[model samples]
Target: MEVPDLRSLRAADTPVVGGKAAGLGELTAIGLPVPPGVVLPARFLNGNDERALADLLPGLVRERGVRPPFAVRSSALCEDGEHASFAGQFHSELEVDEAGLAGAVVRCARSADAKNVQHYADALGVAPGLSGQHSVSVIVQEQVAADLSGVLFTADPLTGDPDTYVLEVVPGPGSALVGGTTEPLALRLGSDGVVVTTRPDWCDESFEARVLGLCLRLRELGRSVTEHRGSPQDIEFCTTADDTVVPVQARPITSLPALSARSFDLTFTPVCHATSDELGALARLDKVRLRLVAESCGLRVGRAWIIRAQASGSPRQEEPTALPPGLSDAPQISFVLQDPARLGGSIVRRFSAVGSRSHDLRETVQLVGASHDRFALIATEIHDAELSGVARRFGDHVVAEVGFGAFVPKGVVATSQYVCTTDGTIEHTEPVRQERAFLIEQGMPRAVTIGRTPTLTPEQCRMVCQAVEVANQYHTRPSVEFGVERDGSLFLIDFVEDGADDAGPRPEDLGIISSGRLAGRVVRVDDDRALELASLDSHFHTDRPGAAPAAVHDPVIVVAALPYLSLESFIRERDATSLGFVFRNCSYLSHLSIVLRELGVPALVDRQAYDRLRADDHVLLDTADRTVAQVPEAESTP
Candidate 1:
C-alpha cells in the first residue's frame, strides 16, 4: 500500500492520517511552512505479515521520492486531544536514511501500543480498544535542519491567563529543548513585547527581536487555532536555515483551568453559605454574631455554648433559658469561665453536642485543636449569655461509625484531577514533554537512595486513566478525585463540588510520606488518645478500637492535629496496628515527619487534609497521580 502524502490530507483526515500528519496537512493548507511529509495509516500492520510489508516498502520511497534523513514519528489516532497531549510517552525516529526508514516506521507503529503509551492513554481516559498496534499511524517527514527551534504556548498554562504567552527557544532542533539538557531562552510575551526571563549568556541581544517576531507570529497562529477550537493551543515551530518559520505540531493546551474557584454553580446546596474569605472575616468578629450568622448560613456551628447564670448582686432571677435548638439533643460538657461584662461577668459554659454524629468527632477535635493551635475560631459568648470554664468530653461516641477492612495491593498508583468544560473537553495538567537532541547525554542523579522505593507501574497509569474517564461521565467541569491501587485497579473516589481552594493540601509536597501511593480510612486520633495509644506496648488492646485506631486487619491511616505525641509512641502504635499511612499538621522538616519516614510508614504533614477529615471518611493517598480523595461508599466496604 502506498503511503498517503500529507498535502493530500486535511484536518478531516485525522482518523486516517493521525494527529501529527493531519495537523501538518492543515498547516500547509493555511499557507504555513511545514516540512513535506507522508503518513502510513495505522492499518499497515496486518498481524505480523512481514512479507507484505517488505513488498510495500519500495512503493513508499517511490511515491515520496525522498531518499535519506527522514523523521519517523508515532501519530496515534487517540493522541493530541483537545484535553490531552500524550507528550513524551511515544517514540520518534530522527534522521533515518532509506535503509533505516522502514525500521523506524515499524518502531513507531510498535510504540503506539507500548506500555507507557497505554498508561498515558489510561490516565487521560482514552479508550483502550482504539489504541492497539493497528491504531497508531506513522509520520515520515523531511528532516528540517533547524538553525533555531522552540515551543510556543499561546497562553499561560498555569493561572489560565489568556493575555500571557510563553515561549521557550533553543539554538538547535527542538529536540534539545525537549530533552531538558540545554537551557533555552525563555521569553514571556504580554501586551507589550518579549521579555527574556532566562537566556544563555552566549545569546546576542540582536537575536532577541528576530526571535520575538517569530514568536509573535506563532502566537497568532495559536490564536487562529484557538478561535476555531474555542480554547488556546500549544504550537511547536522551527526556523529553517532559510529563516522560514515552519510549523511542526499543534495541540490544545490541556493544562488551562476548566473552572475557577470563584464561580461555582453547585448542585448540592451548601450548608455553610460562606466563601472562604468571608468565613475568615466572620471568625474575628463577635463570637455570638458569628455563631448566629453561621447558623443562618446553615452551618452546624461546632464551637462552645455559653450560659448566663445569676449575675453578681442582681435582684431579679431569670429563668434558665432552654438550650439552643440543636445543642440539647446530644452529650456535652459544662464548665465555668470569668464571663465578660457584655454577657454579665461570670457565667456557666457548656460544650453541648449537636444531633449530627460528627459532633462527637468535633469535641475530641476541639481538645486536640486547643493543644495544637490548629482551631482558629473559639466560642466565647452566645446572645446575652456570659461564658465560664470550657472543656469537651471524648471517648466511645467519637469512634468511627463504619470500618474499612482492606489493604491496597502492592503496586504504584497515580492520582490525577480533571475539570469538565462547556465545550465537551476535560482538561488536566501540563503534558510531560522533552525536546530531542541528535546526540543525547545522561545526567547525574540528584539524590541517591539505598533501596527500591514505590513508583508508578504500568498498571497504575491505566488505573489513573480509568479514573479520569469515570469523572468525565458526570457534570461539566466536575472536580474529580481519583487514584490507582497497588494492584493496578482504578478508583474514582470523589467528585467534589466546585469552589474547593486550589491552594489546599498536597501530599507530595510533604516530606514525611515515603510511599508513592496509599489508601485507607481517615481516622482522627485525638491528641490525648494519640499519646495514650503511642504509650502502649505491642500488647495494646486490640478489642477497644481507638477513635483513629490502628488495625491489624484493615489499613488505617492516622490523621492527627499539630503538637502531637512523641515519635517513639507513634512508631510503636503504627507497628502494633500495621498502620498504612499517617498525616498531621506538622512541619515537613519537623522531627515528627523525619522520624515517620525513617520508620518506613508513609506520612505527610499537610494540615488541609487533616482539618477537613471526618471520622470514618475513607481516603486514598496517591502521590504519583498527584491526587488525594475520599473514597466513596460504593467502594469503601471491601
Candidate 2:
C-alpha cells in the first residue's frame, strides 16, 4: 500500500503508525516547522519482506529528489500501548546519507527482531511474529541543531493534577534531551507560575517564554487529541537556537495511579532517613491518629524540621508547599541516622524537651532512624552467616554488626523498644539510668509467692517478675503476674482480665528467657522467694481484704507516675473510683489484691490481660465469656 501523505493523515492514523510518526504527520499538516519526512506504511512488512523492504527503501531514497542525509526509525503500530507505552522500544539510525538510508532502514527493521526488543514486547503481552509485519518508517527530515529540547506533560504527571501541567526543557543536542542524561529546567504551569530550573551552565531570557508558548500550543493539541481519544498525553518537543519549535512526538501518559477523593488535615514532623516503606505505612494511617500519637508523646506535629544529608546541597533549604491530597502533609524529614550510636541520645534529648512544654498537642511523632540501603546490605550479610541457629536458640533475636557500623537486628522499631548500638549489641545498661531507676523506686510493688518450684532458680523468677513489674508501673487498669518455679525457672504466665499496659514484650524477646540455658543469663537473683518479696516493694501493692476479722476492704493498687497512664486507664476505671489513685513507685500484686479484697474490689496482675484490656475496652470475668459496652453508649450513658 502507498504510504499516506503527512497532510492527509488524521488522529485515527496514530494507532496505525505509532505516536512519533503520527505526531510528525499532524505537525506537518498543521503547518508547524516540522522537518520533511515520509512514513513507510505498516502494510509494507505484511510478510517477512526483507527483500521487498530492501528494494522499496532504495526507490524511496531516489524519489526524495535530494541526496541529503536522512533518519530511519521504527514506527510499530503497537509501539505506544495504553499501559506499557514503550518510549524507546525500536531502533533509530541518525545521520544516514540518502545512499546509506536504505541500508540503515533494513538494520532498523531487524532491530525489532532483536532479543531485547522482543523480550520487552513479550513482557507487555505483545505476540511474536508481529514484528515482521511492523515495518520501519523512514523520516527523511533535515536534522536541526537543537539549542534547547525537552519533554512536556499536558497534566501533572507526578500527582495527576488536572489543573496543573508540567514541562521540562534542556539545553544541548536533542539526543541528550531524549536520553534524560542531561539536567533539564522544569516548569509547572497552573494558576500560578511555578518554575524550577537547575542548569547553572545555560541561561537564556527568551528560552523561558519560547518554551511556555510551545507548552500552551502543545496543551491545546493534547486536549484536542485527549477529547477525541479520552485520555491524557505526554508530548516531546524541541527548539533550535533561532527559536524554531518543532513537535517531535506525543503519546498518552500512562504512569499515574488512580487516586481517591478525600481531604485530610494532617502534618508530619520527620526525622532523618525515613524510608519509602515507612512513608507508605504513615500514609495508610489516619492523619488525626498520627497527630494524636505525636501529641501524646509530647511532640509538636507540624513545626520543627531538619535537612537530610543528601539534600543539603540542594538549592532550596526547604521543600515546596504540600503537593495535595495524598502527600500534602507528609513530613519533609528523612529518617536515616548517620550513626546508630548517637541515635538514642538524640531521641532522648528531643523527646524530653518536647514533652516538657506541649500541653494541647496529642500527636505521635515517629522517629525513623534506619538507613534502608545499609540495612539491606547488613541484613544480607547476617542471613549469609547462617545465624539461624543462634537466632532460633536465642529466639531469633541475634544482633549482627555490619561493615557500615550499624546494627542489624530482626526488627528494631517493630519488635524492640531500645535502640541497638553500632557494634550489634543492646545497650542494656542504659535502661538502668538514674531517671529510670528513680521512676522505678517511686511507684512499683514487689511480687508475692506461696511455694517456689524446685526445678526453677531464683534468677529466673526475678527476670519474669521484672517484666510484669514494668508493665504495672506503666499502665492503669489490670493486674499482671510473672510466675517462676521454686528452683528459679521463669515463666510469663498470667495476665489479669482488665489490666493495662498494652505494649507487650518485644518480638525478639518472645522466647528468650533470661536463664543460663540460653547463651549466658542476663538476669540474676539470689532467691526465688526474695524476688517475690521484691514485688511487695512496688507501689501498686495493698493488703488482701477479709483475711482478718474486722478488716475493712481497702484494696489499693498504687499508681506510679500519672504520665505513665495510657488510654487503657480511661476505659478500665469504669467500676472503680478513679478519682484519688495515688501516684507512687515500688508496690506488689499481693498487696493490691489484699487492699482490693478488703475494699470489696478485685485486683489482678497480668501483662497479657492488660494488653488485651487496653486494646479492647472490655472485661473478661471468666474463661468462657467477655463483657463489652458500646463505646459511644458507654461514654454517654455514664
Winning model by TM-score: 1
For each of the candidates, the C-alpha root-mean-square deviation to the true structure, in angstroms, is 28.0, 27.8
Q: For model 2, how does the per-residue alpha-carbon lDDT over 1-638 read when each residue is reduced to its tens digit?
A: 26544444444566566656765664433234556666666555454366666666666655644345665667776665467666776778767775666566667656666777778767877666654434444445555566777777767777876556677787755666677676677777664655654534564666666676666555554444343333566766667776556666667788765433222122333422244454443322222233333334442233222212221221222322232221222222112122222222221111111112111011111121111111100000000110100011012122211110011111100011222232224432111111211111112221122121111123332343343333333333333333222333332222333332233223333221110110110111112222222222111221111111122222222222211212122123333432112111211222232233233332222234332333223222221121111233233221
Query: RMSD of candidate 2 to the true fold?
Result: 27.8
Which portions of model 1 show Cα errors greater than 4 Å? 47-55, 65-67, 129-134, 201-209, 228-230, 259-638
| TM-score for each model | 0.39, 0.37
lDDT, candidate 1, equals 0.48
Compute the lDDT for candidate 2. Answer: 0.38
lDDT of each: 0.48, 0.38
Model 2 residue runs over 4 Å out of place are 14-16, 27-31, 45-67, 131-139, 200-230, 259-638
Number of backbone clashes in candidate 2: 85
Question: What tens-digit string does per-residue lDDT give for candidate 1 at 1-638?
Answer: 24677755656677776777777765544345567877778775534344555566656666666545887788877667676678777799888876666777887777766787778777777777544422878888888888898888877888666667888888879888877887888888876777889878867776676787676566666655453333567888888776667778877788687422121111111113445444443333344343444355333233444322222232232223334433344333222222222111112122322333234323323222212322222222111111000000011110000001110110001111122222223332211111110110111001122122222333433333333333334433233333333343433323323321123223224333444455667666553422322222111111111122132445566776532323333344444234444454333322233344444556654557767777778877665554457887545443
Worst 10 residues of 2 by lDDT: 375-384
Q: What range of 10 consecutive residues in model 1 has the weakest lDDT sum?
A: 396-405
